[model samples]
Target: MKALFVAGTGTDLGKTHVACALLAAARSRGLTVEAFKPVVSGFDPHAPDDSDPARLARALGRPEAWAEVSPRRYRAPLAPNLAARLEGDTLRMDDLVADCRDWLSTRDVELALIEGAGGVMSPMTDEATNLDLMAALGLPVLLVAGSYLGTASHLLTALEVVRARGLTIAAIVVSENLDAPDLDQTLALLRAFEQQAPILSAPRAATWDADALVDTLLA
Candidate 1:
């Protein structure tokens, strides 16, 4: 299966937005797609509408996938490791990686997307981080960043980290942030790293074209 791991510079930077767009685009082209976010914090099973997994499921036209998409969920609205500890549970790195592998093994699809919680260095367990998980997965990364202030620094820092770890980057997407200054400048800054990977820009969610975005991602 062709897989892409969606990671962001920080939390709420539209990782899900990009992942859902890719799923929608793939489905539009009649390509079977599946998405997973192995560990999710701030998830409420009762109020599924407010959860990222649910949003991804809705985008994929599979409401039932919400549960399967995020098997390790905590309601504390904190980092996965901290939240798991608060809930009297433990997040073992090996177990988390095994769960992802098990899920992938069961799927037969053209594209499988794995969305990470928080930023690349966010801790999944006390001993391992999302970056470690990404390396373990051994898939190209679709790095997501916001066009907000200081984004240039954050984006470059993330790029350095990804490179230091020797992970392949499929692309870098700058998700529009309404509170941000001129995005043209942000795009220009990202373009400087084109040699690292393709850099793409995305409009707000309301006006985003999944097909077009997918075309860029695949390119």
Candidate 2:
């Protein structure tokens, strides 16, 4: 499966937004796309349409598959580990890897986008962080970051850790912060430090296009 794990610098950094954008772009190119958010927190079963998995499902044109897209869900708006603990359960890295493998093989999914919860350092379980999961999955990473003040420090720190784990960064997407849309400045700062790999922008626009990002991914 041609898969890319979408991870964020921190929570609410637009991982799902970029993933959905990529999914839309891939679909527009006539590729069969599928998404998996595996572990989701801050989930309300009654209002499932507003969650990350729901957005991804809608992007993939499979709105009904939202539940399947994110199986380990918790009601509390906490980290996955904390949320799972509240339900008297635990998240196993092995189980996660196995489930992902199953999802990838279940269909002829041309492009599989797996989105990680929270930041790379966010705990998925007592013993595993998102970084460990990314390493285990061995897929290219699409690191999503914000365009807010102090974003440079946060984003660079995330990049250092991800690279230290020997993970291939497919791209770094600087998501436009609505409160402070310093997108161009963020891109410029990121470019100054990051000489290699593709660093793109996710401007908050109604007509936001993902064609260029998709082109880089397909290349």
Candidate 3:
């Protein structure tokens, strides 16, 4: 499987946006794609029953059982470990890895895009983090970042950690999240990163053209 983990410098950094873009792009190119959000911490209190795994299933036109794609979910809107602690639940890294391997075994897809919860350093369990999970999966990383101030510092720090772990960096996608009015600065930053990293940029809104981004990745 040509798999990659889509992670970010921090939470809400458009990791899902990038993952979905990659999936759509690969599928368009005749590659079967599957997505898994290993753990989602936050849930809508109003719906109470909502799971991000369900949304992912819908994106891929999969069945409701696809909610099983995620190994864990917590009611609190916090890091997985903390959330689990709040609910008096225990988390084990071994179980998390086991669930991921099981999902990989059963899924019939050419490429799997595993989306991490929160930042790369965020704790998935008391003794493990999302970075550890990525290392366990042993796939290259496609880092998703935003174009705000300190983006370079944030991305560089993340790159340092990823490199220290000896993980392959497939590419970096710098999104200009639509919530911001700054565009020129973001473009300049993107250009700067391309000098060293395989940097791609899109507008915060409709910032991606699936074909182009996928082509860049494959290139």
Candidate 4:
């Protein structure tokens, strides 16, 4: 399966939202696609179901098999390695890679959307960061940037970092977070960048039309 890692400039930048849109888009267009958010942290013990994987499962209409998609989950509202360490669990890179392979083997998926946690530099383990993991996977990245006032600089910075690391960028998605309705400036900046890849806008989470999202990503 061809895997696409959806990374972001920072946390809560609609990485999962974009990922689900990609998954639903591909699936709706008759492409066999699966979503995976490997090694998620920041789980509330009292509310066990509020994890990234769980949210993804609900978004993609695969609520029954949430565990099958994402196996490594941890409590503590921190990075995976730190959170895992707190829960007496060791987060190993090899194990995560193996789990990803195993999950992909089940289906002849056209695209595997691997959504990384936090920014590219966020640590998943003591030894490696999320960017390291993405590089190891050898997949083209789709950088998701939140469309706020300072999004242009954020996108450029993120693009430079990814380019410096020699990561292949498949595309850039500018997602509108918060409650802002004015996207003219953000949209114009993205257009001004004139990056090789396409830059698409994702409106507010609740108003996001999944069908349009799918069409654009797959188109």
Query: Please, what is the whole-model Cα lDDT of each candidate in the order they appear?
Result: 0.87, 0.88, 0.76, 0.77
Shift in Å, residue 122, candidate 4: 0.8
lDDT of 3 by residue, 28-79 (tens): 7788888887677876536633556665665565646455666577789898
Sort by lDDT, top down from the best: 2, 1, 4, 3
The alpha-carbon lDDT assigned to residue 11 of candidate 3 equals: 80
lDDT score at residue 174, model 2, on the 0-100 scale? 89
After TM-score superposition, the amount by which residue 215's alpha carbon in candidate 1 deviates from its true location, in angstroms, is 2.0
Lowest summed-lDDT stretch of 10 residues in model 3? 43-52
**Model 1 lDDT per residue over 4-104, tens place:** 89999998989998888878878989989999999899988689887999989988899878988888889999999999999999998889889888888
Least accurate stretch of 10 residues (summed lDDT) in model 2?
Answer: 178-187
- Ranking 2 against 3 by lDDT, winner: 2
lDDT of 2 by residue, 16-103 (tens): 8898888988898899998998899999999999988899998998889899889889999998888888989888888988888787
Residue 147 miss distance in model 2 (angstroms): 0.3
- Pitting candidate 2 against candidate 4, the one with the higher TM-score is 2
Worst 10 residues of 4 by lDDT: 210-219
Taking the tens digit of each residue's C-alpha lDDT, what string does model 4 give over 63-150? 7656765777777779889989988999888877776667656757677788888998888888988888887776789889887777
| TM accuracy, model 1 | 0.95
Q: By lDDT, who's the top model here? A: 2
lDDT of candidate 2 vs native? Answer: 0.88
Error of 2 at 187 (Å): 0.8
User: What are the clashing pairs of model 2?
Assistant: none
